[model samples]
Target: MDGIIVRRVIPSDNSCLFNAVGYVMDHDKNKAPELRQVIAATVASDPVKYSEAFLGKPNEEYFSWIQDSEKWGVVLTWLLLFYSEGAIELSILADYYGREIAAYDIQTTRCDLYGQEKKYSERVMLIYDGLHYDALAMSPFEGAPEEFDQTIFAVRKDRTIGPAEGLAHNFVKEQQRKRSYTDTANFTLRCGVCQIGVIGQKEAVEHAQATGHANFQEYR
Candidate 1:
């Protein structure tokens, strides 16, 4: 397909960000643990670079927290349950791979480029719909299998950013028109365990604290 870009949806298993990065960088979807370890090791190696003020926690604490993958059933369940990857993880992985990582935000239709000033020669892309992350790739044709996807593009050739931004805007706008995202702030949710209703993440968290219900299904 001529300039066809596609959003490859990664599983929303709390490791979606890592999985998307893995897919773009190595064409692998299961490198979350390995990537998490990389972030932890990088942070540990340079405490001064990744300080308490920068990480919003002590360097050691941030590293430890990033590496732990325990789910909601554990004691630190609340933190783990709501943990979503942001700038910190992106910067670490971008430097580790020596490639610029561009995250196209659907809500704002803006590109957040990590390693933007590093003069990386290659670039990879991801689509962010507020809560989840998905890889952006150039497919050989429309509806092509992901096995045939081309993710990494040459920055020197100008093969990545401009084209990706245009296609991403189209994709993001279509998704917006379809209402394919959760507002998180105002969306209604029903507790999957007890079928009780709650509004927004705040209410859901409060309900979880009072009733020990962790499973929730978003609804209209």
Candidate 2:
């Protein structure tokens, strides 16, 4: 076996923070602090405020254990910063077999988290980019075993760049496509960046080969 295993991060989602921060630390492992600062500067986010969202809500005991698990601490930290000030619309999870489940936990929790306040603005909408979470939560398959399905949360809904089922030859495509679409109130296509949408197939083939970064498998 390749030694990869997947599990649902629920029944108390303490692991989400760990996995998120670990990804940041590991992925940025080689970057020096100054270089990271340059990158962080481009992020346009406030780490301190975002960190607060990481502690959004967990029972004291479970929260402590999650913070203490060394394996995922860094990942969790990054995730907190990534989603800190940003409102969470929803989240999705998918496993090797491709069973997809989406949820509006971010929105629902925001309501419970913020709306309960006496003077909070009802104008604060959970604001879903799409209804994939609505569809998944409204789905009736939670009892299924090992079904860690949440691809939509991680995929783009655009006709260009990515649409999960669309062509994307790398993680850059996956992550960047998301940043392009879901991180804001709207998404737009960059003809220079994602010309694959309008260009002819053969032309796109030539364009993709121009970078030597794409393959047919990107569609699958």
lDDT of candidate 2 vs native? 0.26
Instruction: Summarize candidate 1's per-residue lDDT along 1-220 as a digit string, tens digits.
Output: 2468888989877788889999999999999999999989999999999888777568988778777664211122222334333777888899999999988777666678899789898889898776678999989788889899989877865535566557766887887777766576677878878999888767877888788766676678
10 residues in a row with least lDDT, candidate 1: 71-80
Q: TM-score of every model? A: 0.77, 0.20
TM-score leader? 1
Give Cα-based local distance difference scores for all models. Answer: 0.77, 0.26
Query: What TM value does model 1 have?
Result: 0.77
Q: How accurate is candidate 1 locally (lDDT)?
A: 0.77
* Residue-level lDDT tens digits of model 2 in 8-60: 23211223322322222232112223322332332224344324334443333
Q: Which stretches of candidate 2 lie over 4 Å from their true place?
A: 1-14, 19-142, 147-220
Which parts of model 1 have CA positions greater than 4 angstroms off? 71-85, 156-162, 188-220
Estimate the TM-score for candidate 2. Answer: 0.20
